[model samples]
Target chain A: MADVAQQILLSEIAFSYRSQNARVLDIDRLSIDAGEQVAFIGATGAGKTTLLRLIDGRLFGWTGRAEVLGRTLSPRRAAPRNWNANIGFVFQEYALIERSTVYQNVRNGRLGRTHSALSLVGLFSDRDETAVTEAINDVGLSDLADQRVDQLSGGQRQRVAVARCLAQEPKVLIADEPVSSLDPTSAEKVLDLVRACAEARGATLLISSHQPKLVAQYVDRVVGLKEGQIAFDTPAGAVTPEQLGSLYGWHVADTAARSA
Target chain B: MTSEQRISQQRRRVADWSGFMVTVTVGVLVVWAWVATDIDTGRLADSGGRIGAFLGRMFPPDWSVLPTVIDGSLETFHIALLGTIASIVLSLVLGVLAARTVTPPFIHMPLKWLLAAIRAIPLILVAMLMVGAVGLGPLPGILAIAFHSTGMLAKFYAEAIEGIPAGSLAALDSAGATWLQKLRFGAWPLIAPDLVRDTLFRFELNIRESLVLGLVGAGGIGFYIQTYVRTFQYDKAATLTIVVVIFVVLIELVNHVVRAALK
Candidate 1:
């Protein structure tokens, strides 16, 4: 064990789906310290989700030297179950079991920690139940805890997704385009909840978003990606207009005119 | 006329022509079928009196045969119940195997063909074959129902399984859920209502079909229908027919209640 502060480190990583010829991710190096918050900003197909999935250990079949949470990850095999439990992924589109109640969906996050057979039969330890309840409370969904997810509004559903991840007691939280479908007000609320949850646990947070300005406020550093490569990596406040223009292929004046 | 007006007029003309052609085609088909079956309006009119005579014979449904009708009805119910249970067990396995999401194309494609083949074989034909092989009884009827119903029920089950959202299962995978846990919490909850509704519908069909199994000596109220009609015991046959209609209606009502409760 290195006993180092770097929670995630990747070098010479490249990945592309076998069915498609185009490369989706090609990164030379990236590192994040433990408990640091980072945002990946890119347009669609810029590999933001792919990179986040890679760090979350949910993606495989890549050539890479990637170390996450002091352990080396294999490109061929999935990360171990316990290692997966230590990281929470809030997927885009909520990805909830729509027929299940909010409490059941959040309780599902404790599956890795519970006895497999016991959990299958709907038996959970008191600690697991408490954690699920607390996670639901943290997301301010205690009243809707028993309500089915399909009946919820988009914003409330996203909160349930965050609550599910929070129940994992993860050391690293990865949210992939968490607020893409939400309105501006709801988007900020979800972002705030995700960041606050990570901060409360002293967990590393990695969020991918197309809205760089909004996401930059929650994360300390922003990495701008274009066509599977890093265009710029800078402090959140230091992201330049030129970098944004190069990344999106639109000048600031054009953007201003379009908005006006 | 303007170009747009000309275009709209042409479109309307094409629609009218197609509609006119369809009506002519249907008229021709109806006349062809009428000629092929032979003109029988006079005979059909005369048959009304025969129908009345038949009704007169069945009017006083033999109350003495009530005990026999009840016994046969109970046997029919049991056969349907057992057959439905057996088909459910078989469908659970075949349905998962045939689900495109659960199995590869080669595997699911062949299993789906097998289910379709099973469905194509009529239930009565299957019951007849069962009787020839296993001899006369409810056992053969149950086996026939199970075999015949698996075709439709398994396909329905496969469709239900495929209808589950893939993203929900992936979310469970990211949560570190094992394959079985994903099935229990992710796939099962998402598909449970669909599976229940499908099973209930299949059960209803099974009940209706099983009623006719006894005609093939497979054991049910249908045996009484065959025997009474053959022996010219029209009143007794009428009693059995009435019982069957009541049973089918009751099953339909129960299915409706179950479906509503699921909602």
Candidate 2:
């Protein structure tokens, strides 16, 4: 088994957009352990997604360090060709390339591991074809594999996105609001899929969502953020209703009143 | 209401319609006046007989000239094909430079202006200029067609790149794809169909442009037309016109097949 104590670490990271004169992200220190399911909950514009981008090394112009699987993040550093081979990301919008077929979209996850220029020029590899089909099957989207992504429903597209990540066979899965755009049933099913996939692969799961109830039910740990800063980092069962309110700027009474 | 009141309302509505008609008549008259200054309508009417006489002489299209035009028509097709291929290649590079997503505004703005300037020159004039420099035949025609095609293809390619869905790019970036990888995976697949369609359309346009280029001593069926017309061989000119039409129809059929295959 992979060591559960091994962690992805981000230290003293700060980033700002060059086009805009605002500090979009700031983090002093954060660590996510392997095989742990961590959820980030915060209000809109709290930089939840930005932090995720930073960890993935998508956002540059940042100070300090981000180390994933012990590799320090740097633009000059070629991400281990296999870096994404072991790290899967589910975008908030379920960013499946709309023009491509479901099989092609899922197959993209294997890009990091595929043989180089020669294979691409020849345009056929049995291994890639099999992996892509298996991923579609895993997501229960076998019937829709040949369909264009734009033709799928919102929920179906989201499943395709998840299948893409699954195809990567990652050891760390990062999903930003994987279910926010989904209906309640779809949302539950997506969350269930993410949890089951992470547990099965023994991968650390870091998912961000605004819904506290879903997080509490599905995640093993919750990392709450307020104003781009961590407010609570605790086991899911230990996160009180007061803590959830503070994270979202809602009072417990208001939430309870609304619920009643 | 009384009949008198109803008649008065009808008269007001007729006045409104007459007012609108007067305004439209005045607008038409102004435009007609502007157009009539350089145009001799009386002379045009008088020359109708001469035009009809010329048309009558163009009949009995000399079928013997058909074999001669086959060679010139093939040359025109070659010019269009080579020009379109060259233009598509050059434009792809320039288009990437002009795309705002790939290049900063500082780079994109100047490159866009250069393309605009290139497009400003008429293709016939371009062929004439090349004739002055390179001297006659298909080379000048190819160069002219290529220059015009570059402007059009570059503009279309840049727009196609810009229209790609943002989600795929964001996803690729998050996955740590390099700029080249992002272009290969995220950008190209989305824009390829549009690019292919635009290329086919440009090829169609280039065939017509190549015929015009032949006016400036560039080798094409237009060269044959010029020769036949200068020698007052109306029958031969008519034969060349028919040949050009046939070539265009055949090319259009090929384009349809290529487009279908690409789709």
Pairs with steric clashes in candidate 2: none
True contacts kept of each: 0.76, 0.39
- Cα displacement (Å) at residue B77, model 1: 1.3
Q: What is the C-alpha lDDT profile of model 1 across B141-165, one tens digit per residue?
A: 9999999999999999999999988
Count of backbone clashes, every candidate in sequence: 0, 0
All models, RMSD in angstroms: 2.5, 6.3
Could you tell me how far off, in angstroms, the CA of residue B113 lies in candidate 2 after the best superposition? Answer: 0.6
> Can you give the DockQ of every candidate in the order shown?
0.81, 0.35
Interface RMSD of 1: 0.8
lDDT of 2 at B37: 83
| Predicted complex 1: DockQ | 0.81
